[model samples]
Target chain A: MIEIKELIKNYGEVRAVDRISCQIAQGECVGLLGLNGAGKTTLLRILACLLTPTSGTVTVDGHDVVRQPEQVRRLIGYLPEEPPLYLEMRVADFLAFVAGIRGVPRMDTGGRVQQALQRCQLEHMAGERIETLSYGYRKRVGIAQAIVHNPPLVILDEPIAGLDPAQIVEMRELIRALRGEHTLVLSSHILAEISQTCDRLLVLQRGRLVGSGTEEEIAGSSGREFRLEVLLRGQRALVEQALGQVEDIDERQLEQRGPDELLLRVVSSQDVRAQLAAQLVGAGLQLLELRRQRDQLEEVFLKLTGSKEGAS
Target chain B: MREVGLLARREFVAFFRSAQGYVIAALYLAMVGLDFNLRVLGGGAKFSSEVVSGFFFELSGFTMFFSVFISMGLIARERETGTMPLLSTSPLSDAHIVMGKYLGALLFLLLITAATIYMPMLIMVHGKVSAGHLLAGYLGVLLLGGATLAVGTFGSAVTRSQIVAVFVSLGIGTPLVLFWLLGRYADRPLNDVFSYLAIHNLHFSPFRSGKVHLRDIVYYFSVIGFFLFAATRMLESRRWR
Candidate 1:
């Protein structure tokens, strides 16, 4: 378990992390969602013991980060934005070295390295020097080094930041495979990556945690109406009449596509897509198409982080 | 201790795998060899003891210069390549990381210094030279190298650029080297203090002449200890930044 209480970190006159507090239960995979200067890196660095907090306390599994950093470090594996790798070493040798320094038993170092190699699917690149590998391969090597010691918690920052679409998918699967074995804390600015991979999301804005919960929970907390785009093959007056009958529909806008086709934008306090479709069909209208608008998570994130761009 | 050993081993292997280490070693050996051939051998009618003493004198100067090159990249390169976070976030203390890097650089220094043995052995073959003088001279070179390397390690810890690290070390080391010249113009106790603090003039002269004073050994070791402690403290202070 990880417990952070009113943690604060300052750089000169600027407060990078301001009085943030949270608790992560065992075996939970959480994503930290934020913008560029949202204090995500600073918070992770403090948890990793790379930087000391200016105030408050962070404890990992009963060990205080400031007072017993080494003990805390022993329990967690951290992969920074840029992977901390030695390019001169071969992949296998590098994993072995990390395992050794991370306190893997001498007799089991080779076995542990082999397991990491397999876990990261770098078994074929084991003999290759890290400098010769491509960026995607290097990221795999970074993940391999982090988990070589079988740490209880693994913290990854921007794990899929620069990968291609295919690589991102592969990386997502790999992260998902690490779910049961270790508690994970991953940070990213990409909303879909966080929504797809993480069980819960902690949103930050300008150095403060703005909100945290599951996708639905966060959307519910935002108190925003659910939006749907309805395409109907009927009269606009009948569509408006059907929308008025629905109790949850707060607002509706109609755009005439043609003589028989109309587009309706419906906002409701709850998910009323099924009810809206049934009402339109029952009111002597043909439902041509009905689709929910963009993901509510994006809306919740943008509103929370105060960004105009939806997601990238 | 085991963590220190592991870090040291990694750094030691890194030195051999990188081009900078080989280039530095090769250039140092070539320059030292050229000096030995031109000055020690080319000068005519020199006694074997004088040749040995001159050899130590020239080698100590080269050791000081090359130690700066060897140690300048110790921590600075890690920062440049973004690998320092691995060590900082590990379960090891700052002291262990500094000590391990120092030991690894010192070991490489020892290897290069030991390779210069044939120069002294050549003198032993052609002329009469005392084994005691040979032992004393190598000890002086190694100790001086250790001190200069510690200064360079501190320099590396203070900055991220290897070039800046070298300049920082030279900035700190050049003053001590010139302290002997400064002592000549000073008066009374000031002159005495400068003479005592001089890195080469008063401190290393005895070892060059086949005399191993306990005070000189203590001075070199104290220098090594002081700079290494400073390097460790610099590393610790970076967490605040």
Candidate 2:
């Protein structure tokens, strides 16, 4: 439903979106994963026709975002990080207004508004002024407004950013319920949230596309590295010696969590936990806990983005 | 057109729902009432035409001032509150958004202007006044208010701060309001240019006296068109920004 070709958006001296290209198919819930300043919002705004590209082109549903912005706008709904809400308006009135402005036929506006209210679970609060609602309800109203006209694509920028934990779960379910019915593109800095909700991940860093694929595809393509955590009742030097014996070991670090307990981190090309455990037993070191740690998507993200912080 | 209507309705209704709108309307009515008592009624027995003319004169000034306050937040407040993306991303064109906002403010201004009809009606009871004159006077106030609101809309489009929008509008509006003063010092051609350019003196004076000159009507319409078109262009430029 969307295709971007070498899109570049520069704000004076700062290049907010570099020459990046990606395509999103219809009905795919894609997550834009990046830290702060990743240009995710800028890219999404370009797709929504809210911002014109500095160069290249972005098309939605076969319409150029720059040349046929109105057509492109008709095909997509967008919710920015901060929900665009009129506080004094009732939820239903706001949705009806949105529906009307978004080109929903006048005869269908009431039905569309009701469907949106039901979908976002905002029926009970339809008559309540937006200012009287809680933040979570307000965000739901924002989503309701976006989807009121039943656009083919919905772009949400950090939909769960400021929500409480319970709100986040509800929002996640709400977003999940949108899949298959509409092509969804959401941006987030949270790794787990994006991974859990999206069909594919587009990892960006410093205004560039660092990686794009399923989590496993990204991990495998980036060369899977096995990281292991070992708890051993042995001297730190002895644990290091055991790890040194493993031929696949690329790097090893031993930290003493207790007087006689050592927590070891070993990075290797393959799982050598069994071999390391044998070596530890052969060396007369008591192995308390030895398990192969699965390579986390977080590590892959950090490696691709070259960031030390796990969560952006 | 439907989108414009919907947006306009929302904006118009919003004015009544918010305290700032009431405050602006109340302050405007109070000023008009005070001016009516102090200037029109207080100064001994004046001719009914003069009283109505004086009312329009005071109204024109207040319309200019209050129109700025009413329009300063039209676009700027949307941006400040992060509601601009809703309109910007909608299928509606930039012209539609600008026109809708303009119409909403114009409607509210007209309502406020209409509320002052009692003052003119009072003149009818105490003295004889032509209905045609009253009609012409109200039409003039509407035109002036429309033009001022358009200028203020342009001002709102240029900034994101309501305070800045007010100053920017005043900056653009003050010169036109002061053109009559400039006309006094200039000679011949320059004086004529200043006189013609003056927003109120030559253009609005005729309407104040119950005379509708075609040239004056055209000037007000021209001001309205030029500023509204400017506001539309300002809105469209946001895509690039």
* Candidate of highest TM-score: 1
Clashes by residue pair, model 2 = none
Model 2 Cα shift for residue A92 (angstroms): 0.7
Candidate 1, residues A247-272: lDDT per residue as tens digits? 87788899988877999998888989
Q: What are the interface RMSDs of all the models?
A: 0.9, 0.6
Tell me which residue pairs clash in candidate 1.
none
Which 10-residue window of candidate 1 chain B scores lowest in summed lDDT?
B194-203
Give the distance in Å from residue A196's predicted Cα in candidate 2 to where it truly belongs: 0.8
**What digit string (tens of lDDT, one per residue) describes model 1 on residues B85-107?**
88887888899999999999999
After superposition, candidate 2 runs with Cα above 4 Å error: A226-295, A307-312
Instruction: Give me the chain B TM-score of candidate 1.
Output: 0.98
For candidate 2, give the lDDT of residue A39. Answer: 95
lDDT of 1 at B97: 91
DockQ of 1: 0.71
lDDT of 2 by residue, B113-165 (tens): 88889999999887989988888888898898899999999999999999999
Grade the docking of candidate 1: medium
